[model samples]
Target chain A: MPRSSTYEAVLDASLFTPAQLQPTAVGRLAFQAGTRWMRDHVCSHRTLVHEHRVGFVLWSWQLEYVHPLRFPDADDAVVEVTARIRGPRASQLEVEMTLEGPAGVAVRTRAASVPLRLSGDEALSGVPRPLPDALVAAFHDDEIERTAHRSQVRALRAGFERDGEQLAAAVSEFRVHRHHCEVADQWYWAETLGFAAGAREELVLKYGKAVPGLRRAQAEPIRRVDVTWLRAGQLWDLLQVRTTAHRLGEGLAFVHELGLADDEDGGPYAVVVERI
Target chain B: MIVKVRGVLLRFTDYENEIEVGGNTVRAGLAALTERYPNLGKVLLDRTGEVRPTHLIALNGERLTRSELDREATDDDRVDIVTAVSGG
Candidate 1:
């Protein structure tokens, strides 16, 4: 009755590590599955914006791995993904996703997103907007369950840099390359970090300086990553990625803020939070 | 005399979505479009009065580079503005 969608795919050999195991592959796959679900159910033919000025922004996401996914060279892992909308608020939407394999549940993800209205100048405002009636009715007709963690629905704020002081002094620079901005398969934003050449190296160099033990921690696996798109960059634009690292309980946390190289106060193009 | 709007460019046109211009080249067509919609110019062109680096202009399905904006166009030709959008 409700619009619960399922996606099926096989874990290719290329997705496996040298040990025949997939690390963080489940998370990446689950993210793709969620985007696919949104494209199919929420914004099928219409754009994400309702009245040209109002739209949705991904606020936060959390993925928990229940079991490691292993793709042996002899046998490929069959992956099944199911995603559904859980809570529909005046200005927020909650989604739950489950990833399963032969070993049963491999990962579960919960994501919270916010609806924003553009001001007269066509810039996103902090104020929330009402969800489109059509979208609301779609969820109601499906009888999607109410999210139990609605209490988690807090106003989305820029991470780490709630104040400018936190991000000062840590800067990494990059240039938007053609490969990163190429549109393929109707998806333009291909790379999560927004396609700069040597992105990994730039990130490592910046983060390595901010965090003392980052080089040593490379051997450890990343536990989680959250990305927020504040703005968009075009080709040939010089961008600077500013990073700040904090020491969490047992791991290192990083906040990377991306913006035009010439204008730091103009605002960020995107922000990435990674835990390793 | 027509400039086609595609992808996210439609958002800036208020969805009335059509523009009439008088110019034999892609540059002239965009200049006319921006004259009518100043906001569109802000999004489509950069401070240097050049097409924004992220946006691509195509004449009859043939993409033109920033320098090629001066390429010839006739009233019968179809000029489209293209920009890559995030799937989120």
Candidate 2:
């Protein structure tokens, strides 16, 4: 039967900044909620990665700040997180998470992952495999027809690549440290969020004085974000983030692409689009 | 020329981040460096002794194509051996 996993915890002051709930904190919560959902509703992570020799590599994820966020009134307030398995395509599994506080659903996130076989002395393969029968049975057909955010994100990225005018662009570089990696020494997926945020801040610092419209990003909260991952960066890998500012009608948008600093012609490891 | 070994490649280079070698061409420089560290060669090159597609060799700050490996280099040139470690 199809089911949703619920995780609840007391809100902590550390989870917020001076203004509102931290985006990275929300990402961490969503990730943990998804993991718990998998363990309880589907299967244990150990069974999937160790026994099955498979890894759920994220392809794309989207987050929408649905409600205006503010600091909680009570110090002991609680947060409720619900994770639902949305759709399992030919080789992809999707999960949607909602975080509700006193105000109602404050943040909504959806992630799409593809199972990749992981074993042997050879480098990890990028080829995706179909979900196991047992795994497929864990989800239902009700949400199978739901629209996928990855398609829309891809089309937006393609549009930006083709004819979108760039108001300003900046390139910055960093190395993947051990702290940035997961069990396999591959940079954790959430780190992509940080890279994109850093790139956008750098853009504002460098160009906000000239383009006053860019300063609006600093004043406004990020209303929506869409991310697509193409590859993973390993520990010690030198990576670069290219941030481009664009005019989205009357609003402002930022597109960040992370790739190997060495490969100028290769595609990015990830692309992040943020609307402010 | 100077060859800079980074990340996991440093292990193959005996943890030496930079190695000085003598060669006229980019390929020759890499060959000389790998000859000094056979273990590094095994990981960086393929059966045909060509730089593996997974690894990239950059001259100074510019990436060099496979065909451009024969391009000449001087002692002042800096070579970087790079590969993407993060994978999905």
Candidate 3:
């Protein structure tokens, strides 16, 4: 019963890497397809405006690169993407997306999101709302399979901590800014540090560093990413991000935690797990 | 006293647009507000009456924690509540 939608587009030069194709580019392409599907089927912009809701907030993302994609030098490649609303929770929706090219299936992704609704007089004043009845009924009744390898990675947590020091140090900092809060692109938590444009890149770079042999020496493509928004951070909030690496079979797993430097809670503002 | 509700917290309040609640301290102000709109309490505070971990409360632009709920509030002060949201 999952709702499905297809999005077709031509691979643009902007989505390609300077040298060779990269997994991040493929990931972004798949993410865009999922967003398009949400807009068309679940949380349409017209419905949101009519209902006075802010829009969907992506809580987590899991992507897998199945095949390498390259841009044709002469003619643009045709890309077809399909997105499925796999499940609905209390305040969350799970979307599974697939991107296919002329060669074959290129990438697959699963994302979780919450609907943010406006309140009071402020355009930005809003809170996350439970999934609508209509949207919930759009998916199957059974639980959707979890995309991220959370259990496997979690089991290795203690080992990661014990040998973390030997791994390359991965840390970075950024101050939240006004531009990071744009509604259409950033969404509600962008005012804090949930997710915004360019956040994925920052995570990728940090995770790549922590796991020495994980990233390609030359291209450094990312295979998968899982993120958790633990707390809300506001504009002007300074955040410190730290990452630790662990071995997951042939691939490497990285755990990145971000926290507000000024807050004493010691809890993370966000937690990101990257597998490469 | 003016108790301002920001973001999605407004959905639970009785006010259509603007909201103002009166109390002597952050805790009292929120309590009075929640008293008028019981649902607000459920969203803003936990079973133990503490602010939820993912939510933040600020008094006069200064962020506060559940332990600081007893901090003083005045008729002119502004209180803001914010919670975590997700986006791409």
Candidate 4:
């Protein structure tokens, strides 16, 4: 079953004027993945405006796992489309698309064709019909639940941020004890702390690592790092562990650091991280 | 001369500090320290016998930030091992 539904409509490039296509929250997120990717190669923001072309062509958006975004995007971006759909806009499209990313393999998505009806003033008369009320009702329910969950997250995060001082105060007292040798050299830094991994490969998966490394650099050694647990909950706050490697002739030498604040709001806490 | 890097120190979570090995120049000292404290060696080094990115090395009271450590250590050098770190 599809975890969610997203409707995409492509208009003839000439039919919709530039100013008229004010990106919608749905539209913005629908194409964010492509646009954000384009940002990497773009030299100027104006080019972003000039090259607003995204998966606008129906046939180019084919991928098993390139799904729409989970959050609402405020702006639109474009990225590498299929080679089949390159070059200037043609009179019509002749391609297929597939996308699935935000969620796992539990969802299905379908795209339907929508013809264009241009008026004298360059208006789009034909629009995608809204989903049925019953069908929409389920989506509404899903949206409600998702919104509620997000709202709770936002509320808790806001509360946490508000109490950052207090939380930091409370956080000072605990240290994370990383039991995994794969993690650190120490048996115990803080009697209490939260443990999270910070590897380059993992970091690259989440947020692409710095470009130079991905494109050409050889594999750098992993840094030794751990954190001090500050707060406890579904969400965790901690200090940082950093590792760096140096090469001496054919051998390698490594250095690492744990960053922690000893005091916050006049409270005492074991630095999940110690300042270098 | 062996250097020991530590992991993070927290209040609630479990585990202890890290004792990382460094200074290609001080391999013997680090090996001895690891022998004295087996737990430290196991936690800091990876499958490749290198320090895991999740921990840090501290020399005495000072934290190590040399992008590349001078693996060569003098016989008199003494370093402390600490924990992996977290937070902003």
Candidate 5:
């Protein structure tokens, strides 16, 4: 049988909004659940990375909301999270995860990650490497669904290219500070979600009256989020988040491109699409 | 001049979204603001009393570079103090 793992955590106010869990919080917790699953099912991540000189980098991630996930106002509202490995390939793998409340699953996440060769200094080498056979063997045979990763970002970009009309757009400029960094002084990947939200809010604040269409995003919940990271941003690096609003079905979608504020030729470090 | 406080920094400003302070430059206005809200002073400035680089400034809807903090401003100018989103 394929292995699955469960994690239990007490909810805090910081993790919740009035209607649901904060998207960033969901991303953080979902990643944690997937990591715990990997540690339980395979060798420990520390040993795999430190001893085997292998590291996993997120290539793409998608989250879909099933319900308005909420927790009661209490000191100890515990939520259950479960994750299962899926689509394990030679150099890439995917994890299917769910966050469950009392009623049922509220959010589903599928993230694709690629293994990298850590350099001698423990720096991310950006070089793809094959997964250790023993580690891949730890996964259930049926869970080894070898398939190419489909990027939601590419599809959305293609759609936007065809449409070619932006309802609204704005750019938010800021510097990556120590607070945004990891041990290597590189901005943590999950912080992109927060930057996207801030950029969206700034857009609404600046042009909500001029372009009322963007208000739909301000009032509604994000139904889905797709993210792709192209590179890492280091501390004190000035960056810009370029956000554009678009019509999606009966709702709205926002595309955020984060890149160097001054380096136009460098292109975006990350692209995030949020569907409301 | 009025300095608009945003996001988590609002808690440090007595929940005041907009605050009026006296100054002719961005630095002077910030100085007055910090004097009024001592708690915010600690968070908004570094040991050198310069604005933290993590926070961005917009004067009258135009982005301002760190060197432009000393640029002249009028009493009618609106300064927006936005905390750059970062991981904790």
Candidate 6:
């Protein structure tokens, strides 16, 4: 068993709130049960298909049977949900919704909503595009994002492909830092971006202000970039990234497969980064 | 216009917002536009007079392969950018 698992966050509604009791999008997108229920309903639409780039979050929800859907006297139904945030912007919101029904009985249940907001560099603040799945039946976290990456359904798609010891290295990297975002961020900067104290110095000597993270490349290419508010429940935040170097003529192209984390049962929650 | 380049660490704002870097000719104008955004000098042009990955170049009022814009810039051109970056 992988030492890092995100099982605790998916199964329990103890951290959920009551304000998310609406049937609207803010409620739906932020609640796991609502997200799942909504996806099941949206996918059946003949022309509707969801797409994702790098910033997408996923959710988990439980269906507590309510008589509202059955009888002629039921008033409402209850929903229970759990969610996991993916990417840099991470946070989980467990909530309950009262779905009005044909009967007078109000079925109240708990739900969870995972939000992956665009939180970083305060300069860039905006709502996320959209969650790829409304009701996720069965899809690997990487596969969920891959569904969009493999196919050019979205405007931006980054393919970071890696195999052999490299892929194994990434898997192990995630396992080691399974429970800690800080560790994962540090290692990613060290191993991936190669951030060092003087990293930007070299870039400054070369491109001056032309480069963003212009610092001394003491030992790494990555600068002090950090990840925040990530929520995978108890599921280990396993990012299945793929790295590849396709010649862009004289230039080079690097790809990454940033998959979201999942519970032991394997329900992917997000696609962190498919950046090139 | 200072637009966002997804993978790129930074951006270069000059000329028009749409696209003017793809036309078989845009070196002079692109260089001239650089005067307005001096911060982009090191990125848009190398000491040997070449475009660097520091900034993604597009033309023809559309988004095409980088090679299409990799050629020498003339007086006028076209270039469109969705968001280009080189990140690991």
Q: Which one wins on lDDT?
A: 5
DockQ: the better of candidates 2 and 3: 2
Q: Candidate 5 has which clashing residue pairs, if any?
A: none
Model 6, A1-276: lDDT tens digits are: 101111111212222213211112212322334345334533221122212221223232222223323322332233333222233322333334434444432334333334332322111121334344443323234322211111121222222232211111122123314222221121222122211112222323544344322222222222111111122311122443322223222222222323332323333222222111
Better of 3 and 6 by lDDT: 3
Q: In model 3, where do residues sit more than 4 Å from their true spots?
A: A1-3, A18-31, A49-54, A72-90, A134-166, A184-219, A232-234, A247-250, A264-266, B1-56, B59-83, B86-88
Tens digits of per-residue lDDT for model 5 on A186-251? 677778888998999999999899998788777777889999987666666689999998875576
Candidate 5: residue A178 lDDT (0-100): 64
Which prediction has the highest DockQ against the true structure? 2
List TM-score per model, in order. Answer: 0.55, 0.73, 0.62, 0.24, 0.71, 0.25
* Model 2 spans > 4 angstroms off: A72-89, A120-127, A140-149, A158-165, B1-88
What lDDT does the true structure give each of the candidates? 0.56, 0.74, 0.56, 0.28, 0.74, 0.30
Q: Across residues A167-267, which tens digit of lDDT does each residue of candidate 4 receive?
A: 01111112333342112122222222122113222323433343333211124321111222222111122344332323333332222223343313423
Model 1 TM-score relative to the real fold: 0.55
Cα displacement (angstroms), candidate 5, residue A211, comes to: 1.8
Backbone clashes, candidate 3: 7
**DockQ measured for candidate 4:** 0.02
Where's the lowest-lDDT run of ten residues in candidate 3 chain A?
A184-193
Which candidate order results from sorting by lDDT in descending order? 5, 2, 3, 1, 6, 4
RMSD of candidates 1 onward, in order: 10.8, 5.7, 7.9, 25.3, 12.2, 22.5
Comparing 1 with 2 on TM-score, the higher-scoring candidate is 2
- Return the TM-scores of chain A for each candidate in numbered order: 0.63, 0.87, 0.69, 0.17, 0.90, 0.21
Could you give candidate 2's per-residue lDDT for residues A145-253 as a string of tens digits? 3443353577776676576667899999988887876765577888888888888989899999998889888888888888888877776878999999888567678
Task: Summarize candidate 2's per-residue lDDT along B1-88 as a digit string, tens digits.
Answer: 9998776566577778889999999999999998999987877777888877667789987899899999899999999887644233
lDDT of 1 by residue, A134-155 (tens): 6666555444445533422122
